[model samples]
Target: MPGYGAPQNNGYGNYGNTGQGNGYGASQPYGYPSPAQPAITVGDGLSWAWSRITDNPVVLLVGFGLWTVLTGIGVEASYTVNGVEHSYGLGIPGGNIISLAAILIGPIALAHVGILTSSGRKASFRDVFTFPNFLQAFLAILLSRLAILIGTIFLIIPGIILGYLFSFVAYAAVERNLGVTAAMRYSMRLLSDNVGLLLPFALIGFLLYVAGAITVIGWIITGPLVALMTTYAYVRVQGRDVARYPSQG
Candidate 1:
């Protein structure tokens, strides 16, 4: 909503002389395949993310740190019940409302951060709350979470599969300005085509989460690292260039 500048045309349809790299390898013309361009791997995603974070740790750290503080405040607000401790509520608490607002809005902001950083542009803390299509982004996230929850209820594997499949919903919503259903559908389509290249990143992210949990403070790095990696994958899958930070072997 804020003056975040015109949206970059990074979608699959407008892949012209954008000058962004094709993916993890050397730059190639749009719609043409290069034999030398190696397939993107989980390590590539992580490495690329690490490079971006190291390049601009302050922006990423400040943005995520603000998110964490707001989330904590929301958590604290939700527990107050008529000024009594452990009191029950018939509906969701006000603090939960704040927390939910943060959760719904935070990822979109993080996505913008990753997108801008990948593009080698200056990303500011204001980028976090600058969603032009806030309603659409919110519904997109809510429905995707609901779908994932339902899938997990049926079976753990289905949930995981659906989770990865719809993981790009926020990117779609932010980048393409698509509505809830369209964003989810777009994510599904992209992942379906590139599941082989993308699934490992999801697995790697899970492992990172596990490792971060062990260290407790490790997620400050892992959290933004995963966001950066996912954005890189999204840009590459959409045919944008990301060779500036090449994936490591």
Candidate 2:
């Protein structure tokens, strides 16, 4: 696309979110094991799964869009690991340079998009990558990646687990204003409370990622789709009745 140093987030600028905090029972940052109790049934696997699915209807809808973006980006790159295995390439127009960069920058942009969902804001992938905010996102992603790297030292499975477990790191950075360690703790608490949902949702995320590969130009639409689904999941997990940001489309 644009040059290496091109800015990422100038597309949508601010989403005009005045919610800040304390509006609509959002004051308490840590509301795990919520006392208010939502209408959706949290009991029974079938009931719980259905509740989660329906509560976060945006997940399926948004996921479709995100998968396409991820797939398109993946397709643009060349998938190959050098003989030593230390080297990998995604084979996009930018070649290895952008590929390695995406490995680091992807999560940052993804986090911005995820946060936008939290506010119930609609944003393009281009919007998510907008300017200075991306720097914060990049930092948050780098911290999480470090944790995954630690897991890799132990074993491949451990690394995967670490990545999955810490998936919510973005939540802290984007929402609760938490640093890496705090964000990880926040994720752990949420995950512990809803292990079943977390596992399945993560699986769904992976499946969408894989599924998006069905087409080459899929990302233009899939990218937004994936972001939408993720935000839907977050809203559901937080026991939200309506999406954080109502859908404009």
Candidate 3:
């Protein structure tokens, strides 16, 4: 929290009063001041994410469970398609597509759960499918990934840089209901001003994910925790009081 700029009144006031009463209460307007805390370091981000996960095990776990089921189905479909392609010596399209769709959509749902949980609301598994701007969220995520993939093709560093720069696209799309292009632009703008703090946060998150992948079950915790952490960063960057939530302790 050290490097976050002075906490601006992003109109959300405290974390607890996210304007959930009105549909627009959950997020602040985009033009508010940047976060009051310093840019978040890796340790801070991890700690904050872990705390949220621990504090709201039921919410994160239920969300993760639903996500796991969908992912498992996608993996099964991919495997089945690969088998058919191998047997017939014919190309089968959309095998990887299934997996890609799962990857893109799963986070949007989980991020929604994280947003609700972090705001001190009780979230159910059904909340996973409740994104109001589904079309925009899907398109925004797809475009962001496409951009990153294109960047990686030319140079590894630019791709990695773009990945971090646009990391918040999904959050903005879901929470703020921004259009696909606007979400990407908003994420880039926020990161451009705070990459120094957020880059390490992203790196640490990557390391945690890798460690979790070593034991697939570990992701049940790490995955949602990382999502929650990212949500926390988004809130902080938007100048909300992340520490106001009991989970932040």
Name the top TM-score candidate: 1
Backbone clashes in model 1, listed as residue pairs: 20-241, 21-241, 78-95
Candidate that beats the other on lDDT, 1 or 3, i.e. the better one = 1
All candidates' lDDT scores? Answer: 0.68, 0.49, 0.67
Which run of 10 residues does model 1 get worst, by summed lDDT?
A: 20-29
Q: Which is the leading candidate under lDDT?
A: 1
Report the C-alpha lDDT of model 1 over 1-249, residue by residue, as the tens digit. 122223345432222334443211224344355345445677777777887777767877767767755554544313656886663323445767777778778877776666666655546667766664668878998888888899999888888888998888887777767778888988888898898888888888888878866885777887788788888888877655564542221
Candidate 3: lDDT of 247? 39
Model 3 ranges with Cα > 4 A deviation: 1-41, 72-95, 243-249
Poorest 10 consecutive residues of model 3 by lDDT? Answer: 1-10
Encode model 3's per-residue lDDT on 1-249: one tens digit a residue: 233223233233343334333222343333354245555555666677777667767767777766765555434313346456422212335545666777788767776676666565556657777665789889998888898999999998899989998888887776766778888888898888987767766887798789777887887877777777787777766665444245331
Q: In candidate 2, residue 72 scores what lDDT?
A: 34
For candidate 3, give the lDDT: 0.67
Where's the lowest-lDDT run of ten residues in candidate 2? 1-10
Better of 1 and 3 by TM-score: 1
